[model samples]
Target: MKRVYLLVITLFLLSLNMSAQKVYSVEYANQANVKVFVVDYENQADLKVFKVKYQNQAVKNEGRWFFTDYANQADKKIFFVKYANQADLKIYFVKYANQAGWINQSKLHLMY
Candidate 1:
């Protein structure tokens, strides 16, 4: 019984440590061929408008606001997105899969 209890406790701790968490309002920007999947909580996120200014022009084709949670597409080094309303933004670069659709995968970085 004691060993079983220890195992249960260990599992609980591990789960807690590995829990996926979202920030109050955060964005991740990466420069690579990656598929990004987002789980939005718009009401809670307090999202703002964002954009990637390329050659001094906002990529309006990308869209107006990035959104609370949605998979973003990327094919080049710079990706423009609108969160809601912010002069500056914080981005977190993460991994992505190049499958048919975006799949939640581990954090990735371009090694080369």
Candidate 2:
């Protein structure tokens, strides 16, 4: 009985640590100018605005902050993959511009 209890505890601890592992690391943390709007793409894709955040303790001089349109809202994705993989900003912007028609026409492309 004691062995089974210990096994359960050990397994729980292992799962906890494993789940805490970080996802793909980013090299240029703030270099990417693309504003990751915190909106639920599943329900709506409204661009969220945000203000820049700064902490004197971290940046003694200055810092950048941003406000999202969907501030304090749900996360879009853990990390951007397809959006980042697109050719370049030009292509991405063009695609974004065209998506409005689909949305307006009530033809959202769901990958299901």
Candidate 3:
């Protein structure tokens, strides 16, 4: 019984964490939960975002972003900036999609 309880609790936490992983890019900044910029260099990014091919492949707020084909399917919607200076959040793409994560957690709230 105790083990079962622990498992349920663990799953709950995992779901919450996973919920933060899915992201959708909105067409306009007004529709986005956050405004993002893709930095030319990794060092200039606030978060290292991994673009997952599938939504199930996305992980928690660690920067795993799953771009939904439709905007309504996304957890947190975001808009990309043309320039780093115009962005509220700056991100860099990693080679492996799962390798995504936030270098700076300070701006995390903007997503939620």
Predicted model with the maximum TM-score:
3
- State every prediction's TM-score relative to the real structure: 0.23, 0.22, 0.77
Question: Per-residue CA lDDT of candidate 1, range 3-111, in tens?
Answer: 9999999999875443111111233455323223232532222122233223223222212222223233221232334542321222332222111111212221210
How many clashes does the backbone of model 3 have? 1
lDDT of 3 by residue, 32-64 (tens): 888889888888888997777777877556777
Better of 1 and 2 by lDDT: 1
Residue 40 Cα positional deviation in candidate 2, in Å, after optimal superposition = 22
Off by over 4 Å in 1: 19-81, 84-89, 92-112
Among all windows of 10 consecutive residues in model 1, the one with the lowest summed lDDT is 97-106
User: Stretches of candidate 2 above 4 Å error?
Assistant: 20-112
Error of 1 at 58 (Å): 31
Error at 81, model 3, angstroms = 1.2
lDDT of 2: 0.27
lDDT of 2 by residue, 1-112 (tens): 9999999999998754431111122234343323232333423432211122322121111111222233232111123334433312111111222232122222111110
